[model samples]
Target: MPKIDVNKVAEILKKNELEPTLLRRVMDELRLAVQPDPGEEEKPPPIKKQFVILVSDPEQKLPKDDFVGWVLQIPEEDNVGTTPERVCRAAYDFNDTKKGSLLPVSTIGETLENVPAKHFKEYNTWVKTRTPVLVVRTDNQIPKEVVETEHF
Candidate 1:
């Protein structure tokens, strides 16, 4: 077995446009030098892609006359080959009408590709104020003669 630094060997191969078999030989030798174990099969690297549009509850503000629906796209490779269609969920606001069509709240724990469409009504933290109560009492034992105090 020969000792070779993988990075140095790679640079040499790249600089000379040499065949990789020499580099592979050094790598295999280096692997064997450490533990001298059976060769294990190499695993394929996972594919990385990008996600597109993700809808939040505030953006779905559509006109009262129309109905709305949403859809999402998930890469089949990442989903373990499951061909599931992206679905957007919308619930009625029920604020303007008595239809009770209010939609459910939409939360994003992860990416939009995994979350289904969700409808959410608005939320308000509004509160009202009230005046304190006051009472005036007249005692029954008051004197018959009324004495008026002078206002200085």
Candidate 2:
């Protein structure tokens, strides 16, 4: 097969004004398509695990009748130790609720850090009855289809 000039392809994509995210997706697909299939003896790729990080005011210390919780999806591959801090920083940056603001990372560390991460399937079963206030993908590991799914 002829070699593909990736740089030229990228230049063409850029000239067409393709969005960066779309360009990334296209490149990923191209890479996948070009990869050789593994032999039967070779092990399959590892299955990526999804975790749910729930940030909420469980004690109702905030002065609000209905405080909404933040639910974020992170890949298990992320640094478990620093995930809480990342979540806190994201919450601080993107919070739009009328409920009380998120406590500083230091103050909320005990609450967020201690909360156990739940597998996506397990969390999905548990959260069936409840509606999420805000749900976001904190990592790029999750596929676009999963992120865009109605249930997600």
Candidate 3:
């Protein structure tokens, strides 16, 4: 990934065309997590449900983090079974980019919870121990986070 820079962060926000206010909050959090000054109290990276999405598919026999994985967390839910689908979908969608990326939803244990248990079966978690990965196989244009969370 590019070196941590406010300029890069701003560029990302601009390129993605995100809301300035929300992007600012997320950027501030990223700074705290990725660019904490030394000797300052090291805080636990913001923990909600950060996903370590591997850019390379596991089946492709690629090394870990070989491409461009994104580390993100699921937002809090107001009710049970209401995990932050935005972050989940974001990470899951990223993981689904390649059949070999993570478990392709066709291979994960059926009893596992939190992981994508919808249509398709070959998918599973990249890590043997990971659960709730939210992987998907859809190739259609990605939907907006709001739509994904609500209608997905």
Best by lDDT: 2
Which candidate should be chosen as best, given TM-score against the real structure? 2
lDDT of 2 at 137: 26
Superposed Cα RMSD, model 3 = 22.8
Per TM-score, what order, best first? Answer: 2, 3, 1
**What range of 10 consecutive residues in model 3 has the weakest lDDT sum?**
119-128
Give the alpha-carbon lDDT of every model: 0.38, 0.49, 0.46
Q: Using Cα atoms with residue i matched to residue i, what is each candidate's TM-score against the true structure?
A: 0.17, 0.23, 0.22
- TM-score for candidate 2, residues paired by index: 0.23
Where does candidate 2 clash, by residue pair? none
Query: On a 0 to 100 scale, what is the lDDT of residue 126 in model 1?
Result: 12
Residue range 75-109, candidate 2, lDDT tens digits: 56655565445545444443333332343223343
Tens digit of lDDT per residue, candidate 3, span 1-152? 65667778779788999988998898888777776578888678885754544342435455433333222222234342333333344345545666326543332232233344331132321223334443323234555665535552
Rank order (by lDDT, best first) = 2, 3, 1
RMSD of each: 26.4, 19.2, 22.8
lDDT of 1 at 20: 80
**Least accurate stretch of 10 residues (summed lDDT) in model 2?**
120-129
Candidate 2: segments with Cα more than 4 A from true spot = 40-152
